[model samples]
Target: MVFSTEAVMRGRGDILHGRPALVIGFGKLGSSIARLLQAKGVQVTVFDIDPVRRTQALSPGLHRRPRPRDRPDRRQPGALRDRRDSLRGEDFSHLRNGAYVATVTSSEDELDLAELPDVYTRTIVGDHVTRYRTTGHCFYLANDGNAVNFIHGASAGPFIFLIQAEILAAIRMLTREDLAPGIHEVPAPDREAIAATWLSYFNR
Candidate 1:
């Protein structure tokens, strides 16, 4: 349900700003979400049970997060402590005190946090109910607690694209093409007008 805004708002106050963060999944949505958070200047620490996925994020420019499986001393600079297995355990102790706790993984071997009723899960469900609800299909749980986890889903593609477009559009408007080569540039007037348009879309 397009919850990037709510997710950021709920967790923004707690973001570490410059400190490292651990993102524990590499699925489509998980990866895209991680990229967005990283762009905001948070040091991202990613982990995936799949060796290939983990290795991909580890590439030189990708700044892959170090896993405990990797040699201790040889671990990457942004490597977090060994908390990869625990879903709701001390494995995340390092991030407990950090600004943000972005748990995007749902290992088959491990329990699924989505089935549980937590703050993060509730937030996601609430976003869905708010944005896309039908009289007969409207089924949502009340907000009871904080969403500690955000499981990935196939629908992430469209949502990710929406967020990326908005962010890139903003980046383009703020900085010229020469200043940010990879970023898309939207004319200043167009940007303001489009922003208002998007706001109206959501307001409806």
Candidate 2:
């Protein structure tokens, strides 16, 4: 697993030290990113479509920020809580101001990012599900994200994959070639030999 705990922490530290970061889709990667940011004295907020997971991973006073209910002067009537809960969507005004958003879910729905209101300057990241590549199959990288195809693995054994280009303009930018075919293949070696044994469990 290239996305190990240490690697995830290092990536989180890079963003935390650079700018204020927000993590969406709090699965393994998002959760780890948030915890690492918190450990390094960075403010982190988590949002997810799954309310149950959100409530579990992000509770009041769990981080350096304050929850709506935790503010002493801002108390809404009990009836308003139900109304507020019923209308559940992010107020994207702040996100529009350039909050970096990262997602770790398998969702390929473009609406999750494209529909954000006024979010013209936010950095967004999607996981492996966004682009899955296979051997001999051509692919095109988008302006937003790259394709990650599994090339070197088999149905029963471990292996690497290759990256191909579909669109010439995008391909030229990535490979610096004309409107020609491009192939990206990985070597047939174990790159994880130096990693701790715990990482192998993720592959399983």
Candidate 3:
């Protein structure tokens, strides 16, 4: 999701400086994205229902903690990274004009166009982007509100799949055979093994 956020920012020319960016869901993915945007000088706002979990992973900075109902305040977000996939068509009123909205977690229609308010214009803006103009506002939706990471969500890059599979296999292998361990971590060898697998695959 961090890489996804970076891709979105870079794709949009990194013009997010001093602009508000919304990150829905303050979990691992959303929090990481919020921090990255903040580091890049974009003012980030995170929305999460769980007060405890939301408050836990946030970085030491002035983070806005707005309740669900109070979201989409006066200042519209210039960019929106939705990890929670909770956006609706009615939510468009609070977004900045021409903001690129992408979902990081689910490859589902986070912002269903059918739910969009009666609009005068909807243009298919190239691959993976659709522009909709309602009244005087405009915004872009990536992959038809599907996840930006994998719009074809059924598949994943073989390299990433390899790493995740290897990690899971390693943990399974280690946990089943160890009895003298309680909370054993994947040591250097396991990490090196994973890296070696990647190196070999890349070389191949």
Candidate 4:
């Protein structure tokens, strides 16, 4: 959210307002980004390989939407997934290839640079960037196609502590309580309480 809006689009209200954005995927992360972009007045059109997910996107936009049986939308930034054809060959000059979207997609096909048409020139730019001049446009590719979100180092700021605390709580529960031998998601009340406590303490 911060990277795209702040680093690329320059923020939600100013340049992005009323503009149309094509979101490439419709998973958990993608849905959230699409919602945020919509909230900021950007018209969002989602492209997902799954027909179920596509149906879900047709729902009235809400924070808590239903699952595949009823679940709502998702979004990934521009990604070149040949198998799904979500963002096939769509070259982006504005945003570098942040492969966070690649991690989200299940396609095992590797990105073949040879397939990128008419790339007459390639130049090493930054530690994580390579400049490629195509037939008529120049685009940048992030090295290893790794997510740029970690550029700030391993620390994901104070919000990560909230996740850690939940993990700790889960471990404690596992040790102290008898949970049924199956996958159990953390209950909503527990999550709400933890978030409330974190906000009260940290917002100080």
Q: Which runs in model 4 stand beyond 4 Å of their true positions?
A: 1-28, 38-56, 60-77, 80-128, 131-140, 150-155
Per residue, candidate 1 scores C-alpha lDDT tens digits across 90-172 of 22222232122222323333323344332221234333121112222211221111222332232444345456666777766
lDDT of 4 at 74: 26
TM-score of each: 0.38, 0.33, 0.63, 0.48
**In order, what lDDT does every prediction score?**
0.41, 0.32, 0.64, 0.50
Better of 1 and 3 by lDDT: 3
- In model 1, the worst 10-residue window by lDDT is 136-145
Clashing pairs in 2: 133-149, 151-160, 151-161, 152-159, 152-160, 152-161, 153-159
Instruction: Output the number of the TM-score-best candidate.
Output: 3
Residue pairs with colliding backbones in model 3 are none
- Per-residue CA lDDT of model 2 for 1-204, tens digit only, reads 112222323433422342444444455545666666556555455555566757766553232223432111111100000011211123222222212222222114322334433423332233222221233221111223211112212131222111111233234456655534666423223223323232454354
Pairs with backbone N, CA or C atoms under 3 Å apart (clashes), candidate 4: 26-74, 30-74, 30-75, 31-74, 31-75, 66-70, 66-71, 67-71
| Sort by lDDT, top down from the best | 3, 4, 1, 2
Candidate that beats the other on lDDT, 2 or 3, i.e. the better one = 3
User: How does model 1 score by TM-score?
Assistant: 0.38
Those runs of model 3 whose alpha carbons end farther than 4 Å from true positions after fitting are 1-14, 105-109, 151-204
